[model samples]
Target: MLSPASIVPVILAGGSGTRLWPVSRDSLPKQFQSLHGTNTLYQDTLKRVSDRSLFSAPIVLTHEDFRFFARRQAQDIGIDTTVVLEPTRRDSGPALLAAAMVAQRLAGEGCLVLALAADHVVLDEALFVDACRAAGRAASDGHIVTFGITPTEPSTAYGYIRPGSAAGTSEARKVDAFVEKPDTVTAARYLAEGYLWNSGNFLFPASLLIEEAERFEPAIVAAVREAVELSVEDLGFIRLDAKAFADSPAKSIDYAVMEKTTRAAVVEGKFRWSDIGSWDALRALEPGDAAGNVTHGPVTLLDSTNNYIHTDGPLVATVGVDNLAVVATEDAVLVMPASRSQDVKALVAKLKSDRHNAASEHLKAHRPWGTYQTICRGERFHVKKIVVEPGGRLSLQKHYHRAEHWIVVKGTAEVTLDGRVFEVRENESTYLPLGGVHRLANPGKIPLELIEVQTGSYLGEDDIVRLEDVYNRS
Candidate 1:
């Protein structure tokens, strides 16, 4: 009997997710949202393919700002994560390349990488894992393998994959051609002719990818090679050289490597899959009531059939809305015909141009140690509800302008004020005067919840000057 092949999963979790707005913001993307079940899509993805012996620790490629969120998700699901943070905003080509480099370093030769998006949901996890193993086997034989999801319906929203020939198996198919997102009529014909939806999932030998990178895009290969060779191990994150990586040309695998290489192959995924790109796509997958309404959070709909109303917190009530998407948040509410759900990005653009904070940021912001939500703010005072996860701690830092008063509501807190360490329990309060270095943490097994009242001349996040942190914040 052969030992199971070593597989490394590389999760790309850097999407803006504009269509699912009001709830999904730049600070908190859709990959982090619990749209369908209790776990976020990324967390679900981790659980789907989690096998400690077969797969190594997951290598996550995401934005610098979302590192903490990604780390927290991995912790929540108990998946040991090796996070790779991108210093600059680039597309999946560079992102995947960076992650592939890290994965190569971890698994070395004869190993396979399973690269996948963070926000996709597979209805059949068993089938998905089976496909992954097959793809890994194919990859070990020096082929770049991709998963071609079986299309359930005509979808113009996703790129279509044209299967060339059967590659020695009933399940594996060679690529005849790759088509970009098509027109409605083209999608209909592809769906009828048994074309598969390009699932954007890949499995490849690390050497194959590295060689292809060097062949087609030599500059990227050099830069990435140098970045990997000189990478600094920072706590848990693998820090690539920012300048070296930023110097590489930005391109996707299709454009940079896969389309130009002869080692490309596709495997038919037996599971049901959805990218959930837009609200229309999401609504179509959501379970609807007898009246055909999919409602989440707090929503009331009257005569609203075949509609989706999603909210984060604010109560939403719809009347006579047929085939529409109604989403409401604390600061924004959007009502659009479900047909035009893709237009939500345009609305977000308008909001951004209008300087609306709702478009770019969330009312609740997550840090490496914890999360803080803005409660109230006046001229010189600001209020916030802060929750520090168990074993999480804030930075030992000083604020130049703001003084903070913390009232613990639940759980235990380890407080460090001006280099003095102390414990603050439930219902206890503490104050940190301005210019005093302080830190907050939950050193217990439960969540640390606190109400923070701030009084300052300039109550801003930039007022913080960090001395030290467990999460490597400077």
Candidate 2:
């Protein structure tokens, strides 16, 4: 039985997802994108383990830049989530600490936290939930329980877990050791010796985790404690101390605390899970045709075999390709051999060194209100298509240099034009003069779509001045 009194799920939803490039960007990663289905990876994760009667509201830990997107994903999935926005990516230690502090605050000291990564894809949700329940049971005894996926192959990309003697015949066992990703020979030997994959998921009592942190990393413990204790709460999120939390050691939970703790135990998992860490791994999730070709959008193949072709726009036809990945977008087309997919991170590094914005941003970026896609650009003006969710509002803000013209294409828009609020239904337009305060909101039952044309001497995102916001950004 689940300890229903105080069990909160703390999900780590922050990742760069460098390998799954083109689709996954720095701000909008793979976890937030619809990889192969209607729901995103993060949404699937939330839906798999959520049972309102058994689990408390989820506490999500994510990066500061993706806070609005995280909130929107959670709301879309119908999970009442509380977000803990990290000022920077200081690694999983601070991430979990941030969530733990919020978990304790919202639930209590006696709460048990099930820490899960949002980018993981599990084929069998029932078996996965069963494994989590077993771990949750172990956590009730003040033990830090982590699940290990039963390895079906000798894979070098994942770490291994050697399960020791069984803990009284349950699936639980004393974790004999945690090994890093090994070479082919070493991985083969580990598989022969019956080692499991180290899944980065954990279950721990909130107070015990804090206690262990206090003993092992006193500095992190103090900083996180102070950050959470003195934390500001707004709209169900706990913002960590920017300076202190950023100063915390950048380490994974595996290295920071789990490897050193004696209370650590492992529960064998019986679910088919993939981390979606690389394009190769992601390709394995989707089924291919008879010739081993997988295509998302309109695409055709003449001589392509074992190729992963994805197109966000018009038809992408391939010929005489094998074991290759081709992803064509409106702005970019990425082509790589499956074996060389891991090297895309180096390509991203090169792009960053050359000051290319394509390394970090996608064509469409999600926001608290809705979504915006860059349409066209010129020397002095830029055009974008913005969609506002029903009953959604943008921050009351003004641009210092740029003048904006909003042409409503569909639905109704509640416009705040120069401190005067008004509504414009379909096929109407509004204008904001330079140095004017304006905001856009959706008032109808459907999404509000509009074309925003911004023209100015300088049209950077930093030129905005926010006066007030309902989503709590100052």
Over the stretch 3-59, how does candidate 1's per-residue lDDT look in tens digits?
Answer: 453788899988888878878889999999888789999999888768776777788
Off by over 4 Å in 1: 1-3, 52-54, 168-170, 411-431, 443-445
The sequence of per-residue lDDT tens digits that candidate 2 reaches over residues 126-243 is 8987887788777876678888998878888899888888655355788889999999999999989989999888888988887887778888877777777676766766677787
- Which ten contiguous residues of candidate 2 have the minimum total lDDT? 1-10
Q: Give the best candidate by TM-score.
A: 2
- Candidate 1 local lDDT, residue 352: 94
TM-scores of the models, in the order given: 0.92, 0.93
Residue 444 of candidate 2: its Cα lDDT? 86
Off by over 4 Å in 2: 168-170, 419-425
